[model samples]
Target chain A: MNLDFSFFTLNIISNFIIKGLLFSIKLTLVTLVCGLIIGTMIAMMRLSKFKILNYPALGYVVLIRSLPFVMVILWVFILIPLVIGKSIGSENSAYITYIVFESAFYSEIMRSGIQSVKKEQMQAGYAVGLTYFQSMRYIILPQAFRNMLPVILTQTIVLFQDTSLVYAIGAYDLLKGFEIVSKNFNRPVEAYLIAAVVYFIICFSLSYGVKLTQRKVQIAK
Target chain B: MHYTFNWSFFFKSIGGKETYLTWLVTAWEWTLTISFFGFLVAFILGAIVGIFRTTNNKYLVTFGNIWTEIFRNIPLLVQIFLWYHVIPHFIPIINKAPRIVLVVMAIGLFTSSRVSENFKSGIQSLSIAQKHAGLALGLNTLQLYWYALLPQAIRIIIPTLTSEAMNIIKNSSVAFAISIAELTMFAMQAQEETARGIEIYLVVSVLYFISAFAVNLISQFIEHKIKIPNQTFVKQ
Candidate 1:
């Protein structure tokens, strides 16, 4: 019932919270780029006509989607080093894990985006004598990406929220910063309260942008 | 560095009383328990809050939006930490509450936002004339919703809610972060005791997939069984 806030100063905020925030942001951006790349490849695989190209991609998206993100994080952090015969560090493992895990989600989004491009567009590309990859690169991808940008952005918001999970692997994420402050100041209440508020503010603001983007995307369509 | 995969770790008793496989099964039971109870809370509260958001009253609508945004925006893990660490400090009685109870509450509150969003869209998607017709028929607000709205809205949202149901199962994994001894906890502990980290995590993930996929199949079965012939209102 009793709480104190005097321990929370700008110095502590800058030293711990801001540092952790930068890492979280870095993780999100890095994973978004890498995930989209791998995910696009997977999406193309799934969209291919041959079973060799398709089944593995579908299996991947299904399998990865089914497991919890926490399992993926912990599993990546713990098992990858043993498998690969070297220590990649928790942060690197985290980056790898998010890319692998998020690729499944992004691949689905990518599949839908690619499918949304009219079949006639691809035919038109063929008529123009462009190869399939060339047409995909030049024409369909642009429209597909435009169609699914809002969805990808929405997924990023989820990614931003998910970065807090690295705290379990003992990484210095935003939540980890709060944990340290709580441990240092002996004020779990203030530390966690501030954490919740900060997370809410960032996500809520981002969601407002998502809503705006949805409107714009709809209008553009 | 070299490693050989040990597929036989499940046979040996890690704790002397039970095999590591048994420990994982027990954790699976914990996960299902959290998902089941958490779904109960999420469904009831989310339905109510969803109703609030869609109501004619401005204050209720605002309160509902705030509730949805607050719960939805905050990471469930952060909320779990607050529930596990902070809430007990403020509410003295919650200190005595079971960890299972608090974890369930956290998951429930976290997921209710999504469920509420589903329900809000479900209700809003219905024809406005349904509401007008119910009022014209002299049904009060409660009767109008209960008789004229909820049944149809529920029907409309079965698929979305199916994902939400699976989501509760997935999200219940966060309970392990609070040391709930769930599937993830068993994976970590069993790995520490036995160096077969990959096998343990793989086995645990498969268990999660089986349950979530089972839910998916069952919902699909129900969706198939309950189809109104030629009604294209539901998604394929």
Candidate 2:
């Protein structure tokens, strides 16, 4: 098989690659923020003393964890529009789906973090006349957050990698950009190799960052 | 603007007198068949590579790392497409083999990275004393891994392997893009014919959910049976 590498074609692929990387970065950051907020709330509910609060969170985790990410994305893209009586843009819909699917796993991660904190931490805060919520906010959360940083970062890497699935819904993410290039130029190996290298760089950097943060946390401790 | 619920149409779509049931059954069969074969390939290859990963053999360890990096970084769908669309054009002999074998090989190769990681971590978690004991008994490298290291690693890795199996099932959906006639493709075609996209997808989701749940539950049960005492030192 003869392989042709054209400068003009490479330029086009590079342009699309930059756009795809930007979109992936935006998706990853937005999902991390939204997922953290929603996941924190769900973690709180899961750890609540009341059954009413806990069950809903439990239900959410089970449902989300069981459903495939692609199915969830399809559900949001197709069903949400039907249900809400309005058209959601493809990018926004994809972002929403990512957050929704990610929060379940993140919440479980956060819940474990919270549970790993000793009961005395909460008790110590309460003994100083802090409210239950205040104690959790001040004492439990700070420590748990520190302990969970590496895991959270690892999840962020996973989320970053998973952003490629947005290609299913025409989101023009990294994988989709590669697909377009490969299809257009009939150079599947080159296109895929470029995309794979970019992904590996991002994920490997995130993992390395996690290691650094972990060391800093340990040193501080 | 809700679409009317056509119960008969939905039922006929999935349970029709035509090839709907046949397609569903065949799809289920193919999904399970692919998953089992893929898991077997991954398990055997992963075990060897996983052992190599923890070994002092620099060449073996480097090979394992490269394999993992290449496979794990790429999306399964892209890899499946590459294997199906691109690899055949490169290799003439394998290209002549039937499509089913090629698809199975693709799935197996794609899933093996995860299996290798799981197995490597499992082996790493075992204490050095175990290896010492194996050597004390005059066991060779192969014999030590077979008689001592692998048995313990297998127990440690079962839960992880179970999750990997579920992942294999999920990844098998990508095979649909290559016209493998798995469950997801079945749903897609059925939806196109019936124009009931929502219901068809819902059914497909439920099917996947139930199968995944069943696999998880069975694995959990097996894990409980093979519970290794004092193995809690390697906390996740």
Candidate 3:
């Protein structure tokens, strides 16, 4: 019943927890990059005029958005091995699943970002003798990215929180690191408490930075 | 080897017991219960904190800000684990409570931070003139809020609240980690028992999609019904 701070030894953290902290950061970076690239493509497809382009993209986003991220992670974890004829370890599965799952969310942000760019700007690009793709490349995407950067970062903060769920597949995320130390030291309560504090510090500071960026963006407009 | 899909397992009795479909339905009930009750806790706590956020009292504002930051920043899973594993150690009464109660509270506090932000914005969106007009008429701040401000603010933020509602439902799936018999748990258990991971997960996903879509439809209908005419939404 006692809440003890005595159990938190420097030796325990340095030995068992640092690997998980590194892995969590690595997984988050990979997911952000891969999710953004695929999400941008899906956003374009969803915005396209043709049904062939839009329907599948729309369906994918809707379907993924509706389900829980944990479910999707489990599905990929279980099903990927069956398809590939070998078990990809939990880390690889977590990476793939997060990227695929997060693309749905990132695409939504991109879609709104894309929509925020003025129609006149696209017209102006065309008037200046640029092709549609070239204009989008040079004009629209840049503006959209600038406008949506804060929102994108905010979502990435949420994504970072979700990286902890990789614990379901036995992936050594930050939370799992705490669990390991807790079991090893007979201090599940302290471990979880400290874990919460660590996650809170990271996410709070990141989102605070996002709020500042958002204000700057608003001022620029 | 090609995996053969068994579509009939959904209706057929599992090991000569109840149908697999029934098990899922039961699990779905837990999901709904957690989300609905969690939403209630979120809305009530969020409304109070949100009001504090909008107030001129510097101390209350700081307190509200700190509360929101602490809850909003931490992952829900970590919160759930803390509540489930650690809270009982500190609060002896919690040891007697059901795990589901703990799960609901964890999800509620986690969601309250998000809902409070929406509420804060809704309150802020009212034209300053509304506040001035209420003051000019000799109404106290409480009466001004009760009679004029809150109704309008709630109407303005209904759309955002609806999405938050859907979010709570999806997030409730994390309850399975602590062994709540939610949809995710049912799917995982069924998959393991049947070795039909693909089919089980696909069905679970569809069920989740249907439930979320239904909430969206119902909330949209409510928003349409309650909309204040000619009032534009506050731009993000």
lDDT of 3 at A54: 99
Among residues 3 or more apart in sequence or in different chains, the pairs in candidate 2 whose N, CA or C atoms overlap within 3 Å are none
Ranking by DockQ: 3, 1, 2
lDDT of 2 by residue, B6-123 (tens): 5355435444465566667787788778777877887777777778898888999999988876776666666666676666666767668766576677767767887899888988
TM-score of chain B of 2: 0.89
- Candidate 2: TM of chain A? 0.93
lDDT of 3 by residue, A54-73 (tens): 99999999878888889989
Per-residue alpha-carbon lDDT of candidate 2 for residues A1-221, written as tens digits (9 for 90 to 100): 65455623668866777788788889999999999889988999999989999999999999888776777887788777788898788799998899999999889989999998999988899899999889988899888888898899888887888787776677888788777778877777666656666777767767778889999988987
Residue A84, model 2: Cα distance from true site in angstroms: 1.2
Deviation in angstroms for A73 in model 1?
A: 1.5
Which residue ranges in model 1 land beyond 4 Å of their true spot? B1-3, B11-16, B232-236
Clashes of 3: 0
Candidate 1 lDDT over A1-221, as tens digits, reads: 66788889999999999988998999999999999989999999999999999999999998888889988888788767777878888888889999999999999999999999999999999999999999999999888888999999989999999999887687888999999999998888889999999999999999999899989999998
Error of 1 at A181 (Å): 0.8
Off by over 4 Å in 3: A219-221, B10-17, B229-236
Model 3 per-residue lDDT tens digits across residues B79-175: 9998988888988799899999999999999999988998899999888888898999999979998887788888888889988889999999999
User: How well docked is model 2, in DockQ terms?
Assistant: 0.41
> Which residue pairs show collisions in model 1?
none
